[model samples]
Target chain A: MQPTSFENMFKDAFENFEAEVNPQIWVQVQQQIPTTAVTPQASVTFSGVKTLLIAGVTAIAAITAAVVYKSEPKLNTLVESKDNPVDNKVEKTVAPVQSIEKVLPELIKENETQKVQPAPAPASTTVLKLPETTNESSANNDNQASEPLNTVTNQTKIKESEPVVEVINQDDKHENNLSSIQNTEAEKTKETEEIKDFNWGRISNTFTPNADGKNDVFKIHLPDANYFKATILNINGKILHEWEGENGFWDGKDAGGYDLPKGMYVYYIIATDTNGNTHKTKGSISILK
Target chain B: MDEQQLVTNCLKGDKTAQKQFYEMFARKMMGVCLRYSNDLATAEDYLQESFIKVFGKLSQYQFKGSLEGWVKRIVVNVVLDELRKNRILFDSNAEVTDVLQTTDDVVSNMEAKQLLQIIQRLPTGYRTVFNLYAIEGYQHNEIANMLQISESTSKSQYQKAKIQIQKTLKAQTII
Candidate 1:
């Protein structure tokens, strides 16, 4: 039998062993950090017409709430942004939107801005006129943020359409201490403008394709997209499978239904939401079995 | 900053602190991953999965034991999970009482890379058992519990792994 020294020899040799980690692994790890940490996850219920309206409205409301919370002290932006006539329609449809505005006056002093523009008059006709004295003060206060807001506002209006336009219009004028508000609004509007902001939920990085009913398929979450085309490729860049529409998934099998050997595969997705905006994303998925 | 401070910052989702912590443990943990995986790619996958888990569960690390030990435990568990998921860990009731003929000098003489390659070359079941028992310093019962195999199966796998490693060492010496 081997002496006890044999075991010690192995342990001693490896106890402090260090191998060079591939720099790419860290890059992949960075991407897989839960999105919930940066973007607060808000699950809201809605009974609706088509999936388009539901997801669009949900994304606008949910991301609005998320962006509001993200900047914490910028609670005034939500109330001021929601003060418009169109947003009044959103508040009637979304309970969370209604609740979020109620807590604003108690949380911050910026509610004075909302008091200055409480006109329930249709904002659709009021377009482009800065809130009288607000534009200069806000522009002077946050030059950097307002610069981007100026550039993106037109594009956001064209792509996302309706609902968010008036918010941008008012926010552009009321930029005093509103850097985070403009930033969140710009960010949320940009996100929503992309593919109707179809909340793809979380895309799991790994799945077991052994058919045990738990994550047996590597599903790309496309909750409300009207059209989607994806190709699953091997590391060698050979296309293994291709499918269309939101029901598309890679079951760890080739087109012939043969179980692919367990390893990492790349997925490229191009999808069009109901608003006809196309989004393209590339990522890797691991087949556990 | 010190380890405790680093952990606190990482928990706060500080990107710089997270990168710092990853740099501190990644190499040693990569070494651990290499021992359990069959190739560099698989090992890299294991490393990525382990670090993601470590960061995700960093809140649960109660600061009781050595941080290295806690991190290594999570690394090993991640490897075991991948192995189990792949279904390569087979149960064997057959006993292997044959004495390991390889001497300690062989291990000492071999480069750590050579030893690691030899370990990686072993059958998945044998290599896994050897890793858990001889290298990771776990008892056969603990290995069995972790692998979902019986105690006897764990003992036999370890014994067979030792014999296989000894034979490989002997062959290399002769060559």
Candidate 2:
């Protein structure tokens, strides 16, 4: 017989515990939190090819619409730059070549002192040339987006003969802004991708909700395991309990809070992550109440 | 060396600051991990995973509470998570009572290591409730919320765990 119960023994033993932990544990932890890999989790959020395929198909449709609706000045620059042969076939396909010819700089100066010289004579000519370039760029703005930026540089060099290239560079700035918005969206997707599968699998199995604080709650632990539902069934295949969402912590009770009979029960989980990928896991758990 | 400064530096990608911050809490957190685990190896795993999570979610910590308390909470959660993964519950179905002896001595004259050993030998369910309620000073209802069980269940598990631990200590004649 014991005068003191185990609770007193344990509390006294553990209340201020300061045991020597193995140094190797720190090494393992450091590997998971490498300072450099800490940028954003979105890159790894969506796993498998299905999410990528969907994102890709959507991006393709967007590009096609951009090709049809955007302006033609970028394509004119493409026609001018000897560097991109890819745009030649694109030039034929879009066939906005007629506008390109109309907007083409006739008597474009080889180098008109490389500056406006603040003289109205050059300014008037530049004003005349600038509008044509603006019209074509607005027409093919979408295609201009995918075209190598080198074309812009080539335009600056080609049309430096006129003072209007400075105006086009301003347009290029807006395009740069447009592309930056696209980059941030891609970054957001990358962050979601970091919801990659967790290193800890099998985060749940049996739960004895008798609450000794041990196995009282079985949790299905996907990082973003949200918008999901879990169902528990007896051996006879009768559904006993169901929980909605990825916050799947199940106590050993049905929805009514009655103690489930002690036995093996099957659990079925269907979860959808933030990326809309659905995951399913099923298994049996033994409940001891 | 300041807590806020260390946290800020770690957030800024300073590896040295992270190591310093880790060393500050790792020992104490490891102690909490040990009580929830059956062995030093499992305790080490609990410690490792806990720190990794702490680092991962450090941004969410608002610094409104005690830093140690924040870290300790993460350690406790990780231990529970590991227990769930392993499903190491050993349910006690015995319908037995304690054979009380030596009523004058209300305490056990056992070494701390002996106490830990007996605790280590407890079934997962018992040890967990005992650790939470007895050692960690959580109310049974709070434990219920943490573990997703009813208050009655928490109370019962804690009581059973006490009985089991007392039985082990008595069998060893430490009380």
lDDT of each: 0.66, 0.59
lDDT by residue for model 1 over A71-102, one digit each (tens)?
A: 22222222234424424322222333344446
Model 2, runs deviating above 4 Å? A1-12, A34-289, B88-111
> Tens digit of lDDT per residue, candidate 1, span B18-77?
899999999999999999965565677679889988887888889998998999999999
Q: Pick the candidate with the highest DockQ.
A: 1
Tens-place lDDT per residue, model 2, A1-289, is 2223444555575556677867777776676663533545533321212243346643333323233223223334334323344344333433432332333333122111212122233223333344464434323433444454445443533443233333344444644554565565444322233334412256555667876877787676656664666777676544567677555567878645788877898886656556543455568988877
* Count of clashing pairs, candidate 1: 0
RMSD of 1: 17.1
**At residue A78, what lDDT does model 2 achieve?**
35
lDDT of 2: 0.59
CAPRI quality level assigned to candidate 1 from its DockQ score: acceptable
User: Taking the candidates one at a time, how many backbone clashes does each contain?
Assistant: 0, 26
Give me the runs in candidate 1 sitting further than 4 Å from their true place: A1-3, A35-289
